[model samples]
Target: MDTDIFSLRGRNIVVTGAAEGLGRTFALAFARRGAFVACVDIDPAVEETCALIEKNGGKALPLMADVSNEAAVTTMAAQLEASADTLHVLVNNAGIAIPPGRLLDVSVANWDRVIATNLRSVFLCSKALLPMLLRSKDASIINLSSFLALVGLYPGFEITAIPYASSKAGVDGFTRQLAIEYARDGLRVNAIAPGWHGGTRLGRERQASSEPAVIKRFNDFIQGSIPMGHMGTPDDLTGLAVYLASSASRYVTGQTFAHDGGLTAA
Candidate 1:
């Protein structure tokens, strides 16, 4: 009956990896809708995110911490809680993709690094902030997974992506389990499985090792593979993120909404 169900007014929201790319976009989006955002990241660039929010007349806090580290995550939660009484939304979007390589050559340490950042950070952030989330009338946890989590990336892509894929798939599992566990407490957990976006470095750090020609050709192949016949933009996800975080999705839980321009669908 209340039109505000779709609005995030007066909410306290945390967004990990809020330095740049999709995370920054999400923080700005939430803040624009009246959510007080905590922009957390290991990089100082998160200060830019906070500044942008404040410039737009929205509330924001810039928190610097490594989401993968238990102590750092705990401190981030404590610091955020010291100022905000209750946390209403958490967007776990911090992640990395190691260079593509077969498992035969992938070291155990490399695997741990990927898993720790992509998966463990989700667990640590959620664990540390759940108490604050529990105190809210409506709370939401949105995990950032990938289309690779739903399916192996065609074929060759899988060789260099096992570690990343494994980590994201683990996120899907964690989301479902946690959602079920806390659904009764008015907490909803869900995942956003994004397809490749044009400007977000979606994994461009690894792609940078390739020749420009190779990159262009690879991009053509990827775009052709997507049912939409084009790449996605970072803003494409903001609507979905807002929906899930607001009371609009209160009845939704344990679901992974893919925003891949129909790549996973095809």
Candidate 2:
């Protein structure tokens, strides 16, 4: 069953925010499995990611674009359509985590940026890529959500702002709607609500802080607190991703895959 289901050969995949973190990891994974990977990111570092992919003998194209901008997404889609004709997988992974602040104390500007960067980008990118997706024999839109959306764990260490959590909730909701609307067209839409996988810059800071005692305490707490007894790595999510992107999850749609290492389970 796995053999026939999880093959991504000859597929064209687009992964946003591929400059670093889980986005880059996902992009590389797809490329490794024989997909033509289009690595999109707002950061110039994406060129380095592109080079790495080529160095590995994998096909990759790096594109710079603000996922939040409709115009940029449109242009990117056009370029992709001309090159790939159709896209088999779309990974909406670009996101922003603004400074922590109370909902009332949060600036309207910050709220706008969070919504645009984290939520609107998913809508814009997917809308622009829909036609190309529809043309594919099989297509899937995979949005990166968070366990915060599922368990109401907002007010991250950096910001107490509600915008980030609110935006992710919106993404989860949008995934369901998109799945329903496009299921008949052989398109599946799903969201992955990952638990505390430490990849973000802030997460790294937390792990490597000068406050050794404090960091140690936090680490111990995390290890004992989570049902899995440890934090998850980006690689831990690849199997789930491969399932969703490949034929393995043919009947799976309009659902959230919580890859939280038993946090959600507990």
Candidate 3:
């Protein structure tokens, strides 16, 4: 097979939440494939992501802004416009999952925070970048949903993660609707619903504070539930992300691919 089919050469890609974890990994993956990457994140650590990309002889633009803020998003768009004229891909990966659990554990503040970051930012970034994206002959928007959106699990799976699940479910709906609405405009919208992944910055503080025994038990239980007998890694998403961002998926849109190591199959 000609791997050239998967190349993102000369394409411009914008990745939010790119300071750490999957977002940062995605930015590097795209950069390695010759895409000019824009690493967007609320955290200034996004600069570090871009620096690493540049160190690898790849081009990257670091933009720090709260994706959930309208003025910030607009300013980000303007800054990006000044740097590059066309945006071929937008990865809406910025999100937060905190104060998790059912109604008893979920607070109004936490619910609102999760929605604003996960759901509203997708809307804001996509809408704000439509003009830039429309200028490209082939444009793709890949939103990050999650396995929790498709199933409700407890004890072993996503315990007390209602806000996270809800936000991702909303992402799925948005992906489908936006794809339908923008078909004529030549934009392909899709999503990725990932399952049990590790090395993510989310809940980093908690993990850091966890006792070794507690963490081990948690890991064992979660991995036992996954049919694959293990968890996925940040690098696992590279191919799917690159494919969706490239012409390889020209005929695909409005679909959500679960990169869950067959967990969703059960």
- The global Cα lDDT (0 to 1) of model 2 is 0.85
**What lDDT is reached at residue 92 by model 1?**
99
Compute each candidate's TM-score over C-alphas: 0.96, 0.91, 0.95
Candidate 3 residue lDDT tens string, 154-250? 7743344688889999999999999999998889999999987888776464477567876787678777778988888889989999999998999
Identify the superior model by lDDT, candidate 2 or candidate 3.
3
User: Pick by TM-score: which candidate is best?
Assistant: 1
- Please list the residue runs of candidate 3 whose C-alpha ends up more than 4 Å from where it truly belongs after superposition: 1-3, 156-158, 203-206, 209-214
lDDT of 2 by residue, 77-138 (tens): 88788789889999999987765556677788988998999899999999999888888969
Over 1-266, each residue of candidate 1 has an lDDT whose tens digit, in order, gives: 44787788988999999999899999999999999999999999999999999999999999999999999998999899899979999999999887767777688999999999999999999999999999996899999999889987644443246889999999999999999999899899999999878667555574777778767766877767889888788899999999999988989999999999888888
- Each candidate: what lDDT? 0.90, 0.85, 0.91
Alpha-carbon runs more than 4 Å astray in model 1: 155-160
lDDT of candidate 3? 0.91
Give the Cα error of residue 13 in candidate 3, in Å.
Answer: 0.4
